[model samples]
Target chain A: MNLTVERVSAGYGHVRVLDELSWRIPPGVTGLLGPNGAGKTTLLHLLAGITRPWQGAITARDGSASVLSTGKEYSRRVGFLPQHFTFAEEMRVLDTATYAAWVNGVPKRDCPAAAWAALEQVDLHSKSRDRVKSLSGGQRQRLGLATALAHEPDLLILDEPTVGLDPAQRLRLREAITSIGARRTVVISTHLIEDVTYMCDRVGVLAAGKMAFDDTIDELAKLVDEDAGHGFGSAFEQAYAGIVARLGREA
Target chain B: MTDTAREGHSVEQVLPRAPKSTAPRTGFFWPLGVWYFLAAFVVIAGVTLVRTSLELSFAYEEWAHTNGLFQRSALDITGPLAAAFGAYLSGRLTPPSRPYALPRFARSKAEFLAHHLLPAATVVTAGYVLGLVPIVVKTYSTATTGSLAPLGFVIGIVILNTLLVLGWLFGVVAQSAFAAPIAFAAGFAATLCGYGIGAWNSVTPVVGDVSTAGRVETLAFALFRGAFFAIVLVAALATAAGVLRTRGFQRRLPPVRVFAWWILPAVLLAVGMVRPPSPAVREVNPPKICKEAVGMSFCVHQAHERDLDDLVAEVEPIVVLVGQENLPFTRVEDTALHDGANPHLDPTVYYADVSPRYGATGDRDIIANLIAGSETCFVRPGWEQSAPGYNAFMLTLRLSGDRESGADKRFGKLSDKQVHQWLNSHRNQIRGCAITDDLLP
Candidate 1:
């Protein structure tokens, strides 16, 4: 399945967060990398249909599956992990994940399997009996991820997935996502270039509610390598600086 | 050629760190033992309250009251479980929370609101149906005269429905201070409906010399009592509803379903039951209305009871007791002969309690006549003393009218002495004796 976002625009109240932004994600790991206010999260929201774009259309489709026109249709094949992890702290991990599976319309026959698989996927199967509030931040974040994946969506959209995770936890997630990512599409949004280099196939850098650039990791490397000696981090800094300086010049 | 496309494409593939979506909830875990125990305690408390307070028969207690928050009482024990369910099903349920963005299928707000209000309407409609007891009664009584039309039933239904809805809404939002006023008004409507309909038929004309105004006064009394009973019942159910709403279903409490609905009808039923009858009031050892002329104290049964001859014999002196409907006049007559007074005695007449005067014609028939007669000076408040003065005034008027007709006093001048002399000649039926005792209702 692929998602097509054509010329979309959206905002919070009077201030527009997305200004006629548009892009597409075919089935694979596509990374959205941007500075904090670059609207990376906003783009994910628009594609997911949580925030309706003021000026464009988003359509998602898969072969042998219904084309999704709205959220109800979109969520069937797509799963999203919002940057804000609002775990019902009062809820226990296993029960919470199980209910999410049920709510997402997993077949009754498949529900137990989905719950077990998701808990095991997050490495929280040991704490399945524990209340969410008892979990550490990284575990909670992983728990959030597992809940989203439990329904087995074709497309997984995560905003800041490795946020608040230590290197070890991050490494564990990288392995888990790599395995889950074989056939399903995964879009990870983050500013960390290291994550994009290791995890993303096609990377889009969003700046000022616009898609500043869209290219594969190899192609992005080439853009940074235009200046031969600079490293990846220095190249990322240069690319971000170039966009900001250009905006200042235009303004 | 360089190994097709590069040094980075070595032995192993590095994985991407993508975030997973949030799951609904983990699998069901047994709730804390303490909570389970608390639920059981509350359920037991509720069942006991209902049973002891009502003293109902054992067979009716059944599973509803007996389950006591034990596993038997509930399918599952999770406080606020439904709201969590709502949040969980937030994805696929009809009338969704908000629109989904892209690939995920989620419900819209319109869909959720429709589902939410359906059960609310059904509950209110059911309560409204129960509140229609008054209108149904209006249908059966002969006092209403004509066959109540379909329109009347419809109007009653509308009014009762409005009251029931307000009562329910008032409860759901009980936390708001504004709900108190709605609750009070609903209570007033309840009283007017619950007791006013049936009881109004009996107390309409009023027992004393109060006016059609008196009927209004009595109605206001009923409204006060009715409002009190109604408010208590509705408020209780409303509290229960509020608890359920916040707690997500009070996992331990057996489903009361529409507790307020049932309780309101029970209150109405009680109001109907304990009210003093239309013409019969049972008072606690009230002074007997009958007094033997032999100077003995006696009481007649409450309204619609009389021992006439016994009354005459006991009050050989009283001659008139303003309201004598309670005195066993027939028995008083028998007792009077035993006391050796003339069998033919000038009877006492009461402007009050005229329902007995028009006996067998029924209270409904004499409503107008009783209302008119009861308003006279002798019966009105403070008029017990003023009655003699009015009688003197009427006597003066009679003498003066006759003086002009007799052609001696021209048109005006008949002194008080002449009026007195004329009154002695044309005095009222049994009016010669001064009124000794002014009795009360």
Candidate 2:
């Protein structure tokens, strides 16, 4: 997926969040690292075509010039896992996945197999029939992941995907993302530097709705090397801190 | 790829897999708990109210004959209440504070409304039908006494259910736990106040008349009430659908667009209130049906055509007694159906305005009034006009007539010819109460 966002600006009422922000997401695992209230979720929402940008456009030039419009056709190509997501508690895990696929324009004849396979990827295959409310916190998160992947979207965006997961659950989710990364673009937005170090090939850091750094993981590591006095905490955190320091000084 | 190639392509390869199970689960996806509750409440409450009303009046025979129960019970709070509850719960299916799921299944505002609104409307309509079960059952078993006004009943039901749907639509628009009660209140208020005001007083919430079974006003009221409700319901639903489709609440539609919807119903109500349709007047020519009976020609309206022969037979004896004395009026006409609207104004013709049970009994006041010319002015029991001399004349006639088992003693004392001569001379006093006369010689 070759997705281009051109100078998109959005806000709620008088409080501006994303202002003339632009980025291009290539086919790989990309991580968007930002602190709370850094407009990471809003960016993901814009990409998922849930909210309209006040200015500028987001477009995907794949086989067709499919613009990110607020409609079913646009939604079908993009799968989004919101920062805070929930489904009907009475809905079974498999049914939840199936519903997601069905809404994404998957035919009924294909929904079962697609839902089942999505569940397998998320390692919730054994509990497909269990009610979503009955699941553990980690399992519920995994169920959301399975639903997002049910339609095999070209661009899969997960906002704070590992916010409430245990280490083991986080590891399981990382494996699923790593496995799916080759065929489509996976965008994960979170505050944790470790998530970027563990899962992503490319990383972008946002500070106050503006991009502080956008490069490969190795290029981000170069920032840590330039700040030699930042004594080896995690190299990733050191790099993140250096970028934040540089942006702060410039502001 | 060929159709078969596409059909056979494994979606499993693209998605994850579930663990082995003996059977794949498949059943209905419709959520039913709140829906069932709403349907049951509407049906039970509506039917119970109708049944209780019929029992209280001992009017089921009449109700069943004219489909009066259905007419009166067609529009009520039950349907609106159920719709509000069901719609409020449906929003819980995908809470609005959170993202809505059905939008994923739809592309536009119209499509979105179709996807979600259809199910809600279906549940409400089903509730309406279930509520009508009692009336429908009663109708099938009971024989119709006169020509049935079924069109009125149908219009009533349609208007009622439309209001219920409007209630549901409002709940959908509100999209909160409190939405149900708020929607119910608004709906109940609109209908209750509509009826409370004189403008729609004749229209029942169930969509027809609440009283009087046999009059043409019942049908006229149904059509008028139905039209008004139908127009209002459309406006409400249109606004509701528009609100639901909007991405956020508190956003206002353009002023001109608001006018687009509000104007139609407002104008319709204005026109209806300004010039309501009068009840259709069906003039039944009484003179055409006049039949000679008991020294006078008696005629009744077409509705009471069947009772004419029996009525003629019932009055012939009284006429014979009257002819034995002297007579003034030669015609005794019944104006029951018209409720005295079309009375023979000729003083020579005696007319009785009283309701009666068919094949049972005629009003005794008519027979006495024929001799006494006393009009039964229906008023509150406390405000009755007392014509003492006329009352005395009726008492004299009844005592001396075959109604009592005594001899005509007043006539016996005075010879029959002499008694007749005295009464004829004193006819002015008896008929007009213009003068006082001695009761006893």
Candidate 3:
């Protein structure tokens, strides 16, 4: 599924967060980068169908129907992983995935198989019978991803999916998400430029609630002054810092 | 990714799906915590049944003649116990971050709230109904006059459900660790106040003192109480849903038109309050059970027929002794056998006190009271010490093998002819409470 946000304005209790922001997200691994309080979480929440935009509209690229009109039909096709989430600690790993699938409108009978398939994707299939409380932090994160994938949603929105992880665990998650991104649209919001350098094909930068840049990672690397730095990491950081500076001046 | 891992993923995706017809059914109370709730139901109901059976055996005097056993067994502590369980379960189930943790899915908010609240209500209500089975069996075994009180059960169930909903709402709103204990205290206090306050007692589910003869609970009054609590239950549900809506778990408030339906129960409650059903027990004439022994007839209320044989056996020897001594009364009847409108006793018929203390000692006490004459006229000063009828009463007790002070020896010293002459002279005084010390042998 392709999502198009048009001139959207939203806020929390009179404090405006997103101001006339518009962006188009296509299928593949797309990375979203922004500084603190740039409405990245708010934008993800809007795309996940959890909160409605105060003004403007979000619709499918085909323009068949708006998300508000489609309601549950649109929600059924999307999966969301919040920045901080927890599960019923006593629930078994497989039961957690199966419950999520059923909640997302999968038929009850298909839930277990779907859950197993999703867990296999995240490499957590061996721990299906273990209680959630017994899982390591990294395993729990993978379990969250399995829950998101269990219903086979067309659009997957992940907010800070790789926040607290060791280097080894991060590499494993990156591989899992990269594999899933091959056939679906995966929007990953994070502050780590290294993740974008490796896993994302396209990158979008948000500054002051507006899209400051949206292009290929190569194009982003090209924006860096080669005379100042040559390596990929320094170049990407320099280019990202320069964009935030220009957008701050504009604001 | 390695070819092996890719191949494994592909295999998992096409793994054999379980048959749809045999799929595990999922709903409000499905594959997750339902077994725990089922276990709770069985334990609670089983314990309540055993407790009620023990109470019936030990305290038969309070519930023998009426449907008091069945009615009180279902209501008394079961309602508050269920309310406390509901409060604790709901409080534990609904944590502070539940709204944020729960996924925004295709199911409606009302359905979601039902998913949380209905399991507790259902389990507790089922346990309560199961607990009433013992009451029914005991009533069937013993009682022969009054039928089981359906209205009492209906009112009890309504009150119980109302308390459960109230407890659930408290747990959801308070979201505190103390919610369960607070709800338990509140439920028990509410019941105490309902019974203690005179005005509320008439409308509360606990109908006190239904053990009167020919008296049974009235239907209209019970319906009034049931409707009142049922309306409270509806209001509590609406309030709980509203709370969830504000928390963003629910997308919409209940429809405005639903409030219009409250008018019916409200009107019924109002009519009941204005012209309350009177005389909570209405009089009904039921059949009597009677037996004959020692040339004397014994009759009892039909409700006590199960105990008639044992009673006749205990009192038959006493009746023989009374006949040998030429006692004035030749017929004995239970005091509960009279018509409700006329309560006068026959002068020649001995009216036995039937409802108290139901074993061997209690039966012997009846004959002792008869020989001692009516105690109502013995309230005069010095009657206890100087009354000659008391000596004769002690003599009868001694003859019956009950040990008393020297009355049996004093009476034994008299010749049979002399004893007969003294008793013949004082027979009227002994029965009429007119004897003096000078009349003693």
Candidate 4:
């Protein structure tokens, strides 16, 4: 799946998010990293077609003329887990998956099996019968991931899926993502430095709606050792501090 | 590859090996369809009961020929059943189908009417069929009664329920499933409103004279009370329909087929109206002659002429008036169904046409006059049809000299002294006597 963001400048009323930002997502895990208010969530939303750009456009591989949300082609193939999500408390874990299957029109016969398969992959098959209200915070997050995959979507976008999970749950989530990444493009946005080092194949450091660099984790480690007067931690911190200073000067 | 297989795995590959459990389609249809059927039946039955009850009354002919045994029992079961069906249908058929909330079914609307509005009428009609049981039991057999003025009573409720059911249907179709109850409430209110409108316009249609039934102003009361809410019922249905259409409820649930068992009876009744009234039968009304004490000078007279030959032969007789000096009969004015012997003396003419056993007629009026000085001396032509068993009395009147001339001539023929001897001898045959000069011309 080729997701091309072309010269897209979008913002909420009075506040800009993506300022003339453009990127092309090839078929692979592409991590988006940024500090607080760096427009990371906005960029993710724009890419997911949940929010539209105020200016410019987005197009998939067919090069069809882009209109935000009018084309649900991406939505059909792309699975999205929002930063903040809530489910009906009375609904069982299995039911959450069943509902998504119905909404996506998977017919009646295959829904139950497909839902079970997704739960199994997410390592939550044992707890599928439990109501959502009874699940732990970590279990709920895993259940959300199972629902997103119930339809066998090709592009999975998880927004801070591990936000509140304990270390063990986060490790399990990371492992599941890594396993799924072999066939599907699983993109996740996170703030933890170790998550990037341990899980991501490549990372993009975005600051103030601008990409500082997009490269392999190896390249980032080598660059820090060879050139920065600042330490690795300071160098990573300066990456955002330097861009905001320059953007402010430019304004 | 065929598109079917390409879209997903073939059906063969996906089947879960589970056996089918009866047809789901029919399963859904019966539970849902039965509700609609019952609801429709209730609507029709309720209106029929109320209308039938109001048309029935306490008439002597009605009492004689038919004890009302069948109608009494039939109404008892049908009345409450109809109401229950209405309430059940409204509650079961529709519930909330909003995006998030759970649905709610309705219970009852207008606690005031309940079974009484409709069932009470039915109870009266089926009275005789149940048993002679009692007079009260026979009259109030849930079926319509003459005393109730059922035409307006029934029309009023039909208009009310129609407005409600249709209006609620409109809500279901137009808005979310939640608005169904409003339609029902509107229906109950609509009936009352029609009554009120009928009352205000004095458009109430009454089939008989009610003065003798003792309830005053039956027509005016029925009109204002009946029509007030009829318009309301119609308006409610119209409003609900308009609202429902806009909301697109037709797209969601199955269409409701309105089939009511009550419709059969109602249609039969409607057709019965055009079937030509059954030939009038002389269902007799027993004579009301008060007893008198011997040697009373100041006696109250309340009796009519009786054909002596027909009476001795056991042929049902006609009563004739006795001049003063005839054995005098004095009536207690307080008897039920009696108009005092002298309503005319008070300037308010009453009991000339009140209810009777067969219908409204001269017999009730005669009884009215005896109890009071009202017009009881004559029966108008075709008057036997109203008081059926009074054919002999009417035949006697038809043969009598011009009514205006007869009263004065008969009085003049009897002199005070000469009439006294004739009256004193026929004390058993003549209820009233005394050859008093003031008793006649």
TM-score winner? 3
Which has the higher DockQ value, candidate number 3 or candidate number 4? 3
Instruction: Show pairs that collide, candidate 2.
Output: A116-B16, A117-B15, A117-B16, A117-B17, A118-B16, B74-B206, B75-B205, B75-B206
Assess each prediction's global lDDT (C-alpha) against the native: 0.45, 0.61, 0.67, 0.44
After superposing candidate 3, which stretches have Cα over 4 Å from the reference? A62-66, A202-216, A219-250, B1-29, B55-71, B75-103, B109-135, B145-213, B225-246, B249-279, B291-298, B310-401, B405-441
Identify the leading candidate in terms of DockQ: 2
- The reply for model 4, stretches above 4 Å from the true place, is A62-69, A223-251, B1-441
Worst 10 residues of 2 chain A by lDDT: A63-72
For every candidate, give the share of true A-B contacts it also has: 0.09, 0.22, 0.20, 0.00
Write one digit per residue (lDDT tens) for candidate 2, span B1-441. Answer: 112212434465544344447113432323323434455556645654564454334322333223544444455565456556545654554344332253342334454445455555555556556656555554434423444456656665566556555655655556554677776677667556545654544333543333322344545655776676677767766775555545432244466765797797787667666765654343333222457865578776544455567667776755555453555566666654344554666767666442323431454445555555444222224312344443444434552442342244443355444545556676766555443324533
Q: Per-residue alpha-carbon lDDT of model 4 for A1-251, expressed as tens digits?
A: 55677788876677886788877665667777777888887877666555667887776552343334326555545566766766655556776665454334344455566566667778887777677789988888888887677666666777888898899988888877777666676667887766666677776766767665577766665555335455656554444345445555665
TM-score of each: 0.46, 0.71, 0.75, 0.43
lDDT of 2 at B390: 36
Q: Is candidate 2 or candidate 4 better by lDDT?
A: 2
Candidate 1 Cα misplacement greater than 4 A, ranges: A64-71, A225-251, B1-441
Best by lDDT: 3
Error of 2 at B90 (Å): 3.8
Model 3's lDDT to the true fold? Answer: 0.67
Per-residue CA lDDT of model 2 for A1-251, tens digit only, reads 77788898877777788878888888889999876777887788778877778888988756565556554566767777776766677666787787666555565556677778778777888888787789988888878887787776777888888988899988888888777777788889987788888889898887777777888998987777654655867777877887877776886
Model 4, residue B224: C-alpha shift (Å): 23
Worst 10 residues of 4 chain A by lDDT: A61-70
TM-score of chain B of 3: 0.73
